[model samples]
Target: MQHLEEQIAHLTRTVEELNSVVTNQQSEIDRLTRRVEMLLQREAERAQEGSGGVVFGDERPPHY
Candidate 1:
């Protein structure tokens, strides 16, 4: 029936829109994941070189 066809069309359009949104979000998530991995690698290298700005819990601030 015509009504059923219209409903299918609307549902198809909505699904397409949602799929596009999900695809874009996945791309953004992938980019952010890569950035985090890079940062972690850099931090690890800095720690190995003993040049990282890591502080211990018992250490006081310079102004203390």
Candidate 2:
């Protein structure tokens, strides 16, 4: 029936729209994941070089 066809079409469109949104979100997640990985690697290297001067708990900073 025409009504059934219309409902199917509407549902299909909605599904497509949701799929596109999910794809975009996945791409953004992937990009952010890569950035986080790069930052972690950079921080690890900085730690190895002992240049970050990261303060630990209950420890005062060098300027303090």
Candidate 3:
């Protein structure tokens, strides 16, 4: 009976440790996702700016 109780305690401790590790990994994933979204927004802005520059793609006025 004592041996059985000891085994149960050890298993419970192992499961608790694994749960903490999974929780930490989820938080890290959320942080990285936000960073990627910010980078994508900045890239889109840069592309739009390039398409509207002088002597590039935008149209010029009359009297040239």
* Model 3 accuracy (lDDT, Cα): 0.87
Clashes of each: 0, 0, 0
Query: Over the full model, what C-alpha lDDT does candidate 1 score relative to the true structure?
Result: 0.96
lDDT of 2 by residue, 20-51 (tens): 99999999999999999999999999989999
Candidate 3 lDDT tens digits, 23-59? 9999999999999999999888877888533463566
Q: How high is the CA lDDT of each candidate model?
A: 0.96, 0.95, 0.87
lDDT of 1 by residue, 1-64 (tens): 9999999999999999999999999999999999999999999999999898767999997778
Misplaced by over 4 Å in model 1 are 54-64
Clashing residue pairs in candidate 2 are none
Model 2 lowest lDDT segment of ten: 52-61
lDDT of 2: 0.95
